[model samples]
Target chain A: MSFSRRIIIPLGFVLLIGYYGQAQSSYQTGLLPALNVNTKLNRGWSINFKFESRQQLQRGIFGEEHDQDYEYVLSDLALVAGKKIGFDQSLAGGYLMRFRGQDMIHRLIQQFTIVRRYSSFRLAHRIAADQTMSAGASMTLRLRYRLSTEWPLKGQSVDPREFYIKANHEYLNVLQGEDYDLEIRFVPLLGYKFTDSNKTELGVDYRLDSFLQDHPRQRFWLRLIWYRVF
Target chain B: MKYIFPLFILVLGTFQPLSAQLKFEREYRLKSREVPPAALEFMQALPFTKKIRWYREEGYQRTSIEAKTKHQSKRYSIEFDTSGQIEDVEVIIKWKNISAETRQLISKQLGQNHQRFRVRKVQIQYTGTPQALREFIAGTSDESRVTIRYELIVKAKTDGQFQRFEYLFSEAGEFIKRALIIDQNSDHLEF
Candidate 1:
């Protein structure tokens, strides 16, 4: 397929989904933006620092009284350390701090990742587990798996000044005391490589949760991400 | 605010050094008409009926055109310069294809250099005149006029640090030279 057509098809699909979302009472729309910095260390080790924030753009049911006012959501700061165990696999551990209005939450994370390279694209698999803690609340634990693929739009690989497409599908199983639920997420992104150490991506992150309950919830977020390496 | 963080990161990224020593390599697919006529002519003369894919590679201060295909269960890669002059032909082969003595020597050398090592790929490379290579590929010529070398991709641990390298060896399994294969950062995929 032509590069422009490839981009346009998915974009159109996302727009269609957005249009459909307006009629659903359980839908919420927001913006998600994040910045990440990665640094390499000695002996096949690396570190990453990330900051992310969320904001609500619109909410409520279609053809009814809806709240369209902007609202600030929450912020997250994370630090991770990674070790390359093999040419294609790595192990990592991290910590995250979340600030939500007057509440503060902490999370501990561990993950394993494997990446495979093909002639014209790359595929990645990740399995992770995390535990979240907050004052006066039961501990929550989540287990997740994600599969993602990336391919250059203009060449065999994504190089400086080139464009690429990345898509991810993930499933999460969550547990909090007597409660258990599942969430699924899909993200499709358009990325631009500024240089060897820098890149930016804009995309839509769609999540479906609460399906195990009586009222299922859906979220659509416009996501912007920036990555820098040192 | 959301705007402040992204702006700060963009400014920081703009200041990062573009080191001259960093290697830049890229490959692009080419249409049949986009390739040099001479290269296409040479390809047309081959007896193989398999589909051939053409590519243009830019790296190491030079650009080269490559044709890749599979024949009789073996993978073949033929490279040519920009002016359509043939450079080398490489065929992926098994480690057992090498003589037992040569394999022993190669293994000994690798064992001596690294605490742990694994061979990922092995390719036998041929370099000679176009006529000689054509005859060899056709099974009508001997190795008298054609030079043979072995190329291997290896991942090894040296001094407690692991790295990947591309190694070249002579026909007798004597070590020639090795180059480090720098991997692109994959933070986005991992995190």
Candidate 2:
């Protein structure tokens, strides 16, 4: 097939799927903007900070006449210290202070990550454990695992001014006092490498929260992140 | 039966068989700082070369530095390692420039190794130059003394699968070695 045909075919199928698969689920759209900074303290240690904002969108991206109604859902600041373990592994611990409307929560987080490379694709696996605390709410413990893959769209490897694609899937298990819940999230992002030390990503974060004896709640999130290294 | 055919198409589309692949090449320019100092020094020492530029390339375990320059009527590319040791010097040449005897010999070898083969790109390479490298860097040697080699990038079928391979041969068309051309994947450093 010709180059134009190759692209037109898959795109045509996607449009067909969109036209036919119109079943709507119980989900809310959220927009998140975040800035992440990593400052290297030494050869082995680095500190990372992220400021994040979550806004609950009242309408979809295509709903133009709705006047862009949205509400500030939550915000958080996270700080983490990472230590390089080996060529392709790292260990990190962090803290998060979050405010959802009027309620505040604190979290302690620890994680380990390993990355492997395979012919134009990078695969990364991260495991994390955290504890969350609030004034009147019971303490919560959560364990999560995420697997991600990244590939350069236009070159053998991503470099400055190049575009890449990253996709990840995460599973989270939470225990609050005696109640247990599970959440699964999938994110597909397109990223641009502005320079060696800067990158930007735009993606959709789809999350499904399942609780015992309750119908699962779905969250569709538009996520944008800016990453910088110093 | 209705579900089986749709499922088959989905599976076939999602999981591509390990057969022939589409090959592509795209070069990214690197900053001067990214180029190793040793590779830069070696390039500076070459005589009669002008309009030199440097780049760091992917698709290799060790860092590879590529320097392109115009020497008289011909354009030359010299690939070096991080330590400034020369890997190969290549000059792009037309397919007809290759002697018919050598081309026929290469064709026979490819026929024996693969079910089918097609040549895609060709370069005349110079190697076996440890002594020549030292003398050249010291500004005491000429280019024509080194042994010439033919380096080819070709698509070939093997084990019922087709993939690109880089083939190395002597000027006499004796096969030395061949390596499957695979991409280099690296994680952008987080910090």
Candidate 3:
């Protein structure tokens, strides 16, 4: 398999159910943009309401956008906590939920993520299970190295903010009687932060699929994110 | 790609300041000298008081002041045998760019908060990520730096004289909790 052909093979025809939860362009997102509202009730607990009204705009691995018509509303309550073990051991976790009216269909989901930070970069492993009998896992390996020239912009000081561009890659492998598999995203990002809590990110997303040599489809988007105090 | 240890080092180093907490112990020491009538007359008039004992750890600020009263008949010890007695006295004054005038003006505001705000061991905490903290508050964040300052302070009066009027005027201004001392019986101090 040529490199591009290998990449598209999975990008075009993905296994029955496989999503790494990248929060990027989706077959259902173009028609129904989603709204997420989260607030801090106190210290350890938080409530998040999600309203998604768009369909996925799947722009095959390379060519045109394929409209995947679907919508659902999801309400997720999360309990987050971090524990430090010994001198070099630490753990951070989030327990989440999905409700009906949040995005379109009435479905529930549970996702668990665990990460380990080394001297240079952090590695993440995530597992998500849907109401249906489909279960999947995603593995992401990203390298974050600090750059010197970038100072922080105004409006951020309460937390330590760092500037680094990372190379991100994800893979999803599923099993259900037969191999319905493959999809991957290769993104190079130019990211910056204001204080420590606010973020401004920009990047290019390159995708590859399975069947029609999942054509190499790419796009650009900007994202803004804020986290509540813990 | 470089040293994985360095990345873990980065995260661990960020949380260092969270544990550098401050502890305030209760203690105080008081001294006075009468030029002619008032201070002397007050000491002399006291009945059955023992003379002074010059001690370093007894709460005296300096040995020079301790020497001034050494062997002098006027020197006397005032001891309050309570468990939380003023063990040592220190006056720590912090000159922050705080709006003292603004706080004074908020007297009415505090009155309106009669239900929400109550007196207790006050601890003020600020939580946010370095990147976001500097962005939300103007001039707070570096281009991509994180390390915001969080501070806590405890203050009490020098004499515990909450009700009286005159004790408030003494030149002894200090952060009573961290700097000054008070006797539970000193009706002149307000905390």
- Cα lDDT tens digits, model 3, A71-139, are 332333434333322112223343434444423222334434433332123334444433322124232
lDDT of each: 0.85, 0.72, 0.30
Stretch of 10 with least lDDT, candidate 1 chain B: B15-24
Chain A only, candidate 2, TM-score:
0.84
lDDT by residue (A123-208, candidate 1, tens digit) is 89999999999999999999999987788887678888889998877889999999999887878899999987999999999887
TM-scores of all models? Answer: 0.85, 0.53, 0.31
Q: Which ranges of candidate 2 are over 4 A from the true structure?
A: A1-25, A59-69, A211-214, B1-26, B29-126, B129-191
lDDT string for model 2 (B74-191, tens) is 7687888766678878887776789999999999999999887878778898775756864643458765667788888876767645456888888999998787765332222231
Query: Best-fitting candidate, measured by DockQ?
Result: 1
Evaluate candidate 2 and give its CAPRI docking class based on DockQ: incorrect
The residue ranges of model 1 lying beyond 4 angstroms of the native Cα positions read A1-25, A61-69, B1-24, B142-145
Worst 10 residues of 3 chain B by lDDT: B182-191
Q: Between 1 and 3, whose DockQ is larger?
A: 1
Where is model 3 more than 4 Å wrong at Cα? A1-103, A106-112, A120-123, A127-162, A174-179, A211-230, B1-19, B22-191
The weakest ten consecutive residues by lDDT in model 2 chain A span A17-26
Error of 3 at B175 (Å): 30
Ranking by DockQ: 1, 2, 3
Q: For all the predictions, what are the DockQ values?
A: 0.48, 0.05, 0.01
Better of 1 and 2 by TM-score: 1
